[model samples]
Target: MDDLTAPTGREEALRAMPHPDGTAPRALVLGATGYLGGRLVPRLLGGGYSVRVLARDAQRVAAFDWGSRVDVVEGDATDEAAMGEAVRDVDVLYYLVHSMGAGKGFEAADRAAATTVAAAAAAASVGRIVYLGGLHPDGVPLSPHLRSRVEVGRILLDSGVPTLVLQAGVVIGSGSASFEMVRHLTEVLPYMPAPKWVRNRIQPIAVRDVLHYLLGAARVSADISQAVDIGGPDVLRYGQMMNGYALEAGLRQRAIAALPVLTPRLASHWVNLVTPIPRRVAMPLVESLQNECIVKDSAIDALIPPPEGGRTPYRTAVGLALRRAEVDEIETSWQDADVLGVPSDPLPNDPEWAGQVVFTDVRTAHTSASQESLWRVIQGIGGERGWYSNPLLWAIRGWMDKLVGGVGLRRGRRHRDRLLVGDAVDFWRVEAIEPGSLLRLRAEMRVPGKAWLELRARPDADGSRYDQRAVFFPLGLAGRLYWLAVLPFHGFIFAGMARSITAAAEAADAQAGTG
Candidate 1:
């Protein structure tokens, strides 16, 4: 999963192609489990191409919801025998594989895979090869990551198959490594101090628009064979992207000071320290930032006109990404739980589940800190206790909820020091209650989706451990859109909530000692 965003140019390319429905034009997608390839497969299928996917883990490919409509072939893209078999009888081949993140000698591995695919495509007489690569100025010194991308394109072209290369910059969408980096950094840091490349110009495209262009490519005049640069309408610096993301999130102004001393290697390690993202993914992303990645030729635009519906603005793309994240959060099925490595049993101890929708946060802190003690603190949560911190924001959100058919803070809890399952506490309903260990709440207000707050605690070696989870089940597409739109804000609020709960628990323990 490298790039998650789809270029509008790819959609334009697909739309320009005639439908393969009746004749069932055979198409094969290598690396179908990867981010971009994950999206490209469905788009290709929807465009009426008979899609076959080649993946190292065929089970993962089979797990996708694309249904029985597509064929799943188990094979490593780099394997010559596998590549040959996968490309057999295919009319169009999409080379979406990359050797990065396989540890050292990734370039050599990438070159090998490209050569294998190209040779197989040529051998099979595959008519076209659509490849996605990076957008870097030709003839300039390239980063290892970008260099590998360009060389891969050359390998495919040299095989004598008519190749359509689509080179792109940053792609903005959920699950995209690049987009995730930006989203996490901008949302977590109140202000950012970055490397000098933050000032470098670049263009960003949306995943949806990219899907559109990929579908368009299938029908594009078979004669057009040159590389095309795909991008969104806006050209901005990396710094500007940070600022724009901040504004859209309704977050405070993100101040960034570009430092001369921070190199990409150092920055990648810094990224690992600040984010859950691994260093391998961050290094290539950061190194590429040293160059300006704005689109150069309008040749692609001229070849694939906006009238065919492939152009989208940067802001719109970002907005779509946020909304899509929210929607995905709500509609996320139990199948995703397997991928997330969540325990199958809902009551699994020491487990956590997270959900987000809009810009509000609600968490039920669970601990071995006795139900009475926990309820005491929860009942007195507002007013003088001040909600641990950020009472103002809590008050505002509560008021908003109240204005739209919610009890808000005014109702407080009944029987301030005790609670039972199914009992109503202010605007929250106790969905589950296990004395001394767990608490769960179901919201009674109008929201983007069905929402809940849950807490589970068990004794730890020291004293006790706590786990909190917010859950949302989206109603439809709108509900999903709502969850992603507020995902980052949820991260901030949750962080504060965790700190507050820990502090309060410690204080309560201290008070018991004194008494």
Candidate 2:
């Protein structure tokens, strides 16, 4: 190759310009508490870069699994002083923060934060700045969220510092709002209606591949200071994506019909009612799908090379996500417990149902059986062992769930007598389990709200105490109605189940004594 086409020594050498004193290149990550940032920190650390994060609450950052491994600067991103403090002595700056809300003015908020960080990075003379932006078709009207993301990329690129903006579409992974929408919508509705955007072409990328490009961006050639589009190997319609997820999740291929009149607002409300994702997060995600979002060129491959085995195929990505969701032990990792559509702090208590409304039923029973027996009965509560209630009632509910395309009772248990953090038993996923004290199951059945069942076994002076609770967090008026309509059966189902459990334990004790 000619000298002009050949790579320069400077390009080949890892320039520690930001830390010319020979120390490791320092990376400053904003939005460390957000989804992508939380995943990227460890990747950067593993890539041999020292990591620092600027968070409004240092404790929240510390709460992550990789928290203690890096330095945390407590500050808000919009504050100039705070941004400046965070940018000081940083080599590469990563901007992964963005906001999506149901209300107005989020655009202005995003613009301001981006401007502040860009100015800070420029002033600090950081080696390079890396920004994660959304992929959108050019010259087309964009959703407010996508528009703001593109604007933020412009702000960072124009900051007088070399910037590598990696634009990605619909990141597929657990905990991603986009992926969660797909997961819940497919799991809840077998026949999806309306939304012409469902047919728009979308190039979805996996989270692992996104992180690969992001990590490479920290050292992308200083000469490249433009946005590079990245995506998976295949481009599929939004409907195709949903059905792909269904195939991996072992559900029937979803039948989706595009209704011309279904607007994003109305669609989001429908999503809220049918899925665990609330309207607030679902609205922006739905709107972003209104236009085609695909990679524009091969520029990204030139700069960051495809992930190790090449970019993940859409179906392969879906399968990996389903498998990963089964057993991620880290509290902040991608294992999406079906408790909520996506992760947000649990709604705080308030008098009104304006936002959060939780309904619960409690039943207790006392018996002359040891706690061990009671726990054995409690832990083995579902799938063939039975729900400890009327078998007819359990079968009816299971059929009802199956009719709505929910997981139903068919999944059963992974082990006859063993339960783990993410094991699935019938229509419930084991959320939490304490050896002999409590077994909590999160409902995966199609419902208007979130639901959980707790079976507790405690030792009493005489023998053992068995307590059972059914908790439901209603989504809206529909969710409220769902709870009310089913309230009458609680006495027969829940109360009897609690009593039956303790009785069975006592029967075991009596039978053992007879032996």
Candidate 3:
């Protein structure tokens, strides 16, 4: 090549580029609230980068504990104006948006979004564009999902923007849709009869390791605009992955019998039946399984060396995912509102109908206060009494639940003087009541899973310690959604319930002393 057309000293230029001294480099992460983006944002912040997020819901973006370290803007990636704003004055732009929501024209939507992002990055003169794509088997008929992932990468590459594309297959993590689907199916089903795609080879990556690569890619030289395939150390077929998951999750031994009659279209429905992933998301994933997802090269390993202990194995990944699931079982419940449909009025509170367990504790203290006086204070729990604490948050949740066709706090108590089975108690229903000793109520709100409320007054060393507890057990995919979505407010509501019960008991004692 002639000197005039020769490549410049890109390496020297990168070396000469300014560093952020003690401060972190500013990064703009589009779709920062998504599954991959969500995981990536925290790691970037930990690496000392001032991160910015662009998402549709400002509330959802704010919900993340990015704290004061990150900035969030509500913007759509496909819109030119919004995309330009999101990419402006950023060291690196992470394109993590994927249009997998099953509408009629998702493919076109996916291409348009990519094109818009690429054009926006080029126009804004962003330093580099980092994208994650899917690995597809060459020389084979590609499914629409895999084809669109590849097409999205091409759209960015053709835009003349320096792009670092990392192609990967299944990502194993606690909340990851793909990982959850695999976990639920393996745990719930004993013997497996799956589609022909069960034999297809796949390379799964741990979510932590995937986050590692993404963070490393952001700080690398802007000139390293190459498509790198990333995978875990192990390469196994879908059947093997299922076997490992079953073993890790403590399920009985399972055997897969591949059948020719099962197609991708049929497999999606089957996955929907067994896993928490809905048909809208399951269909695309099932279709992509038809193509082999084995990594073509180990270039990413060389770029960002694996940890000193070596990369996590597929079995280890399954173990970690299951452990996370167990840890997250409490504090939230998963339930999909769409799947449960609209709850009917006068819903039954039977344990068989609700699928919940109730625990109660009752104790008597040697106090001068009469039982009648104490019961009066307990009966008046909602409305003016307010929750034990965090009244504003409880009101907000009750309002939201009411808007969603649930029995909100407006119900109050059926009869404050007495309680019985199936009697309404504010937003709760009396599932069972043992006179003044114990009371159990089932939640009558729209939730991902079954929920319950229990009240018991027991004597303590000082006086009587009233114990009020709320418990939730999830149903399926929807149930998990319900739990995750509501967990943040749990501490506030639960603490309030405890304080209110204690205060109510004290007030009753004071009233009895006055009488």
Candidate 4:
């Protein structure tokens, strides 16, 4: 092996030149909208790197707080021309793109994309290419997803670029795919008839620690270029990870009965039937669980030292992730990924169809309270503070949703009294919010139709007028039937909700007046 410090080909000039600031290196992140990539940008910026992100659609990351702080170039990595444009003049290129959940032929797609990215980086004279890949045991058949990850790393390394591959197991963090699987499985099932793969050893690392390693990768001596395995201090079975999550969530210890007869296909279907994860995404994850993913080398520790306090324990990581969820401080979510083959449209209220059946129940009420006071009560709608009206009915609805594999009410608001464009509120996601005027929530519960709840407040002659609307776009006869079935509840739930919000606002106004 040759020292990575000796630059070869086009990288010679790039390595010799210093950044304009003569401080930190310039980095370009490929998948800025992804769970890990989204989190990595902030850490890189905080580390004083001039960060640039390349995304297929820049709008996907427009809501990120650091969006304005970094340079964004919109392009797809699979396109040679786009890749060339995105990889230009960067000291380090982070390749975080993967095609795991994209249905059939994802492996080939990943290979093609990696080839294009590597060729473009080599052409653009990128000094180093940092890639994050999955850790799998050798001498065994690898799952399609993990195999694709490894292939991508190989492609980058063979491109004559100084590529540093960091292979990791399950990443524990809020809104991560693996962590969500553990969370949903533990929270929903008390007695799980799991497959034999549940006993496979896995070393899960905290997302915070992953970010630390990524930041450290930028400053590592250029003489090191090889694959490094990273993991937390503890190595536990997949089943134990679930048990640890349950403990952190304050749930009772679960009973796991390992059944050898259950295959990966059956396990995927079971996961689809129980958790919010769909069949497509769960299938690959279930398939990959059969391989042991524990770390075999500690070479990464020599390059990037561990966090000051130390590696986070599994239980502590779970608790921290849950705390972020409780406080509505999550920066990104698995739902943010467009790989689920679901609609990514932010607002579904387009009225372009001339002939379509749209059902809506709109109600309005006038209150003596000011707009500001009412807005406060409207934003604080879900979570521990149950729905303002018909608490029993809401609980029954949530229970029914849970029975049908929907998100239910367990995913409470990320904040107690604030709403953002992508924030999850119970079974609804906040679609839009205007400070003193409007808040719209889109339904995420399993339904035969698209639904939204829009609330608006405006200044009236005397005080303020509150308008509430429940809009549903039915799919077919089944959707119509579903709407008709829930029609009775709407009258009771929506009507009472309008009155409740008004009363609360009026009470607040009165209290303010007295004060």
lDDT of 2 by residue, 180-294 (tens): 6788889988898959998899999987778777877877778889998989989999999999999899899989999999999888777755654555656777888899988
Model 4: CA > 4 A from native: 1-24, 55-60, 74-85, 99-116, 158-160, 174-177, 180-192, 221-225, 242-255, 268-283, 322-339, 346-357, 386-408, 445-451, 472-489, 510-515
TM-score for each model: 0.62, 0.66, 0.63, 0.81
Q: Please tell me which model should have the higher lDDT, number 2 or number 3.
A: 2
All candidates in order of TM-score, best leading:
4, 2, 3, 1
Which run of 10 residues does model 2 get worst, by summed lDDT? 1-10
Mind giving the per-residue lDDT tens digits that candidate 1 earns over 31-144? 665667766776677666788888655545554557367787776767787778888888788887665444478888788888888888899898889888888886689999
The TM-score obtained by model 2 is 0.66
Residue-level lDDT of model 4, residues 199-298, one tens digit each, is 9899999887787677667766777778899888889999999999988899988999899998887887788666666556677789888988899988
User: Candidate 1: what lDDT?
Assistant: 0.66
In terms of lDDT, the best-performing candidate is 4
* Winner of 3 and 4 under TM-score: 4
Give one digit per residue, the lDDT tens place, for model 3 in 431-475. Answer: 556555567666766676667766665544555545565666677
Candidate that beats the other on lDDT, 3 or 4, i.e. the better one: 4
Off by over 4 Å in 2: 1-22, 328-515
Report how far residue 49 has shifted in candidate 4, in Å: 1.2
Local distance difference test, candidate 3: 0.66
Lowest lDDT sum, 10 consecutive residues, model 1, at 333-342
